[model samples]
Target: MPKFCFVADLHMFARRSNAERYQDQIIKTARESELCILGGDIFDFRWSKYLTEDETAHAAVEWLREFDSQTNHCQVHFLLGNHDDHPELLERLPFLEQEMKTFEWSRYYYRLGDSLFLHGDVADKTMSAACLKLQREQFAHGSRTELHNRLYDVAIKAQLHRLAPPAVYPCKRVAKRILNYMDNIGHGRETGIKHVYFGHTHRPMDHYLYQGIHFHNGGAPIGDAPFRILQRTVSLNDGENGLESRIRE
Candidate 1:
C-alpha cells in the first residue's frame, strides 16, 4: 500500500501568487507520501518576481533541489504546464532529473498503474494531441522579451485570462481525444487506466466519470474558485480502487 498526494497550479514565484502560504503544508504532505505529483505550473516564469528569467530559472532549480532533499522518502513527479515551459527551465530539467534519484520530470504525462497524470493543456477543442504537443514544444524553446513578459503579467492581473468560456467536463469530444492520445502512447483501455488527474484549467473536479473513466483535478490556489490539495491511498498487491478526496486546511 502507498499513499499519493497531488497539488497543482501553485504558480510558485509568481508576482501575486498565494502558493507561498501553502509551502509548509505542501512540503509536509509530500514528505509523508510515497509519491507526490506536482501537477503543473509549479513555477510561473512569466510572472516571476526575479529580475531576470535566468535568475528565476536558477531559483526554480534550487527550490527543486531543496524539495528533493526534504522529501528523500518520496518520489516526486513534476509535469510541465504552459506557464512552466520556459526555455531556460526546460534546458535545466534534464540535468536535474539525472541528478536527483527520487525526482522525475515529464514534458507531457505520467501513467502509474490504473491512473494517469497530465498537465491538461492538451484539451483544446480544435487541436490534436500531436499538434498541441508540438506547439508546446515550440513554446518551450522560445524566448520571451522583458517587455513581452511585462505585458503578460499585466494581462493576467487584469483577469483577461478569464474572458474565455469555461470548459464543461465529461465532454465526449475531449474525452475521446484524451483516450486517443493514451492509445497513441500505449496506455489505452488495455492498460486498465480508469482515473485521470490533471491541472491547467484551474477548475477542480473529483471522480467525475465519463465513458467509463474517472477524472480528478486539484484546483489551483488562485482567484476565487475552490481549491485544495488532493490525496489518495491504494494497495498495489490487492488490486484496490482508491478514492480521490480533498485535504482541508
Candidate 2:
C-alpha cells in the first residue's frame, strides 16, 4: 500500500499566511510519505505581500523550487487553486515540471484508482458544473491590482474573511456539486470514483458520505477550522480502514 499525505490552502506569500512557520513540519511529513498532494492555494498571488504581479510570480516560482528541492524523496503533486492560478505563473509550470523529477502539477484533479483529489474550488457555491468552470476561468484569467491587494491586506488584518463560519458543516452541497462536476468531466461514478479529497471551503471533513461517495477535506491552517493532514493508505479494497488523520499543531 502507498502512503499519502494531503494538504491544502497553505496560502503561502500572503500577508495572512503562517505557512512559513509550519514549513519544517510540512516538509518533514511530506518527506516521510510515499505521496504528497498539495491541494492548492499553496501560493497566494491575489493577496500577496509582493508589490507587483511579476514579483509575486518570481517569488512563487522560487518558492516552488525550494519546496521541490526539499521534497525530492517523495512524489509531490501540486494542484492549482483560483488564488494561485495566475496566467503568469501558469506559464512557468512546465519548466519546473521538467526540472523537478519528483514534482508534478495539475490544473484540475488527480485520480488514483477509485479516489479523486482536487483543489475543490470547482464547487465553490455554484449550482451547476458549467457555472463552476466559468467561475474558475474568470479567476484564472483575472489579475489582481495593487488596490485589490491592499484591500485584501486590510481585510486580513481586520480578520474579515474569518468572520463567517461555513453555513453548513461537512459541506454536503459542495460534495454533491463536486460529484456533478466530476460527472460532467467524465470522471464520475461510472469511472469508479468512490472517494473525494478536496480543499477551499476551509472546513475539515472526514469520511463524510454523500450519495455513496466518501468525502475528505483537510481544511486550511488559516481559517477557523482546525488544520488536519489527511493520511490515506491505499489498498485495492475500498472497505478497508486505511484513512488516518493527524491534526497539525
Candidate 3:
C-alpha cells in the first residue's frame, strides 16, 4: 500500500565534485517515494573528529537539514552502518527528528503486508561485533590528526588496488564466508519472515534465496546508477480471515 525508496553506502566523502548533484538526486528520490530508507555509511566515516564544530561540519549538517526538509512529507529511516558515527547529526535541526529515525546497531523487523525490510548489517554477528569494537576504539581515541587521516586514506587506496576484481573487499572467499555465516543466523529457521531487503555489500543483487528465505540487496547509491525498489501490497479482509501480499521491483 505504501511505496518506499531504499538506498545505502553513499560514501559521501569519496567524491566531492558530485556532492550537490547526489543530494539533489536523493531529495528527488525521497519526494517520489512515500518513504526513504537509508541503509548506512551515509557520512563516510566518523565525522566529529575531523569536522569538529567548523564550517565543513556545519555545511554538511545544513545539507542534511535541507535534504530532510525537501523530503518532509516522506518518512526516513536510517540504519546504523560502520561509517556513520554521529547519530545526533540531524537533531540540531528542527522538525528533522519527526521525519527521520536513526537506529544504533539494531535490526528493524518491519512487517508491511508479510514483507520484511532489514538493513543487512544485523545478519552478521561476528562482523558486527568486530565493527563495534573498532568504532569504540575510534571514539576513545578522541581525534585523528591530518597526517593520520592521510595515512589511513593511503592504506585504503592500496587495499582497494589489491582487491579490484571483487570491487568490494579484497578477499572474495572471506567476504562470502562472512556473509554466509551472517545470513545463516539472521534469517534462521525460527524467524518466519518471508521477504527481506538489505544492503552493505554494495553489490546489486536480487532474488537470492538462502535456506528457505528470500534475500534482496539494494546495492550502493554512489556507484553505477542509484537503484531502489518500489513495493506494492495487497490486502484481503474476509471477516475472520485476512490475507496480505507484496510485489517488489
Candidate 4:
C-alpha cells in the first residue's frame, strides 16, 4: 500500500514561512509517504504582493525548487492557491521551470484513487467560485452562478480595502452550501468521488461525513496555524479512514 500526505496553506514567501513550526513533521511525513501533496498556498502570494511586473513572483518559487530538489525520496506535488495564482508566476524564473524541478504544479484538483484534492476555494461561492452541478435543471437555474458572481463582485470591492486591512467577509455559510451542493439528501450527488480533500479554510477539519462521503480539510500550516496532515493509513487498502489527520499539538 502507498502512503500519502497532504499539507496546505504554508503561506511561504521569500523572507518567511510558517514552515519552521512544522518543518520536522513535514520531513518525517515526506520520508514515509509514497506521494506528498501540497493542497494550496504553499507560498504567501497575498502578502508577498509580488504577483505583477517582471519577476512576477519571488523567493517562494526558488525555495520550492530547492526544497523539491532536496526531497527526492517521494513525489512532491503542488496545487496553486488563490494567492499563488497558478504556475504563470514561474514564467519569469526561466531557471525554475517545471522541467527542471522535482515538484510538479497542478492546474486543477489532484485525484488519487477515489480521493480528490483541491485548493478548496473552487467550491467557495463567496470566493468567486461554485460547484457547477448546482446550476443544473434539478435546482434553481442560474442561482449558483448569480450568487458566485455577486460574491466575486464583493471580493473585488474588498480588494480596495487593502488600506483598511483584515476585511475578510465571513464564508462559513458558503462552506455549508458547498457541502449541500456536492452531496445532499436526494440524488443530487454531484460527483462519484468517495473522498474530497481541500484547504484554504485555515480550519483543519477531520473526517466529516456528508451523505456517506468524507470531507477532509488540510487547514493553514503557519503562525498559530495548527498543522494538519492528511495521511493514508498504511494497513488499510480501503478508502475509509484514509485521510488520517495529524493535528498540531
Candidate 5:
C-alpha cells in the first residue's frame, strides 16, 4: 500500500516568514508520505505583479527546488490554479518540471488500486466573499490601484455569480452553491471512481455516500490552519480490489 499527502492553496508570496513555515510543512509531510500532491494556488499574485529577477521571487523559486530535491520518497504533483500565471517559472526550475505534473483548470483522475484522487475544481465557482469584501474595501478607500484591481475583481465576481453563486457578496454562499453543482455533476458521471478530492473553496468538508460517491476537500494551507493533508491507502486483491481513504490534520 502506498500513502499520499494532499496539500493545496499555499499562496506562497513575498512574506519570508510565511514561506519558511510553508516550506517546513511541505518538507515534513513529504518525508512521511509516498507522494505529495499540490492541489493548486501554490504562489500568490503579489510576486507576479512585483519582484524582479534578483528579488525574493527567485529565492522562493529556489526554495521550491530544494524542497523537491529533499523529498526523495515522494513525488510532487502540481495542479494549476487561477493564481499560477507563469508557466516559465516552473519550466525554468530544475528537477521540478519533470517531477511535477501540472494540470489546467480541469479534472484529474488518478487511480491507486480501487481508489481515485481528484483535485476537484472543474465545477467550482470563483472568489470567496472574503475576497470580494477586500476588493470592495479597496475600491471604497480610493486606493491608487483600486480602479484597475476592481475591474478585474468585478469581472471575476460577475462570472462566478452567473455560474455558481447568484449572490456576489458572501463567498461562503457562493462556495456552497458551487459545491452542490459539483456534486450533481460528479454523481452524473460514470468515472468508476470511488473517492474524489478537491480544493478551491478553502472550506474543509468531508461527505461520503453522496449519490454513491465519496467527496473530500483539501482545505486551504493558508489562514488559521497552515495546511491540510489527506492520507489514503489502497490495496489490490487478485490484481484489483481494496482501497482505504483517510484525512489527517
Candidate 6:
C-alpha cells in the first residue's frame, strides 16, 4: 500500500512568506508520502485581474526555482487545474521547461490503482441549480476534449481569463449537486472507478459517498483547512453509504 498526500487549490501567489510556506509544505509532504499529487491551481493567474501583466507573471512564478530545487527526495506530480494555463506555465517556469523530468505535468487526469484522479472541473459545470441533470445528460456523450474546453470556460476563460482566488469550496449547493452528479455518472464505469479524488472544490470533503462512488474533495487553503492526508486504509464516513447500493452497485 502506497501513501499519498492529496492537496489542491493552493492558488500560489507572489508573496515571499506565502511562497516559502507553500514550498515547505510540498517538500515536507513529499518526504512523508510515497508521492505528492498537486491536484490543480498551483499558480494563481487571478492576480492578473489586478496586477500588470508582467507583475502577474512574475508573481506567479516567483518561487518556482527554490520550490523545484528542493524536491530531489520526494516525487511530485503536477496536474493542470482550472487556474493553470498549461502551455503558459511551461514557458514561464524554467523548472517546468521541456528538459525537466523530476517534476512533470499531466495535461489530463491521472489513474492509480482502482481510482481516477482528476482536478474536478468536469463535474463543476453541470452543478448549477437549474438544468443540473440536463447539463450532465447533454454532456454524457461528449468527448474529454469537448468537456475540457467547456469546463475551462467557466473555471477560467469566462472570468476574464483570470482564475478564482481561494474561496470556500464545496459550498452546500456544490456539495449537494456534486453528490447528485456522482449518482448519475455511474461510479463503476469501464475504468472500474470505485473512488475519485479531485481537488478544486476548495471544499474538504474528507469523505463523501454517493451512488457507489467515493468522492473525496481535497479542500484548498481558501479557509481554515490547509490540507488533508489520506492513507490506503482510511475509512470513509457513511452518511449515505447504502444509497449507492440502492441505486445500482
Best by lDDT: 2
Alpha-carbon runs more than 4 Å astray in model 5 = 14-19, 46-61, 93-95, 98-118, 125-189, 225-227, 235-249
Per-candidate count of clashing residue pairs (backbone under 3 Å) = 0, 0, 0, 0, 2, 0
Range of the 10 consecutive residues with the lowest summed lDDT in candidate 6: 240-249
TM-score versus the correct structure, for each prediction: 0.80, 0.83, 0.59, 0.63, 0.58, 0.59
lDDT of 3 by residue, 1-249 (tens): 466676666656544112345666677778887667666555554433445534433644665666667876466665545554443443343344443452112223333443455454433334453454454345421235677767756755565422442454323333344445444445333434444566656555565665555566655544334445433332223321132222111
The digit string of per-residue lDDT tens for model 1 on 102-141 reads: 9887777876666888777766544555676677767542
Candidate number with greatest TM-score: 2
| Error of model 1, residue 1, in angstroms | 3.0
* C-alpha local distance difference test of each model: 0.73, 0.75, 0.49, 0.55, 0.49, 0.52
Candidate 1 deviant stretches above 4 angstroms: 126-129, 140-174, 234-249
Q: Candidate 6: list runs displaced more than 4 Å.
A: 14-23, 48-65, 90-97, 127-188, 223-226, 229-249
| Model 6, residue 148: C-alpha shift (Å) | 27
C-alpha lDDT (0 to 100) for residue 44 of candidate 3 = 57
lDDT of 4 by residue, 81-145 (tens): 66665344545334554455455556445555556667766454522223332221122211133
> How many angstroms is residue 21 displaced in model 3 relative to the true structure, after the best TM-score fit?
4.2
lDDT of 5 by residue, 1-249 (tens): 677776666666523213445566667877788767666556554433344433433654665666666876366655544454333444444344554443112213344454544444443444343442233234221112446656645654565423432232233443344445434434322534455566655556565445455666655644243345677654555333343232211
Model 2: per-residue Cα lDDT at residue 40: 82
In model 2, state the lDDT of residue 229.
Answer: 80
Which wins on TM-score, candidate 3 or candidate 5?
3
Estimate candidate 5's alpha-carbon lDDT, on a 0 to 1 scale: 0.49
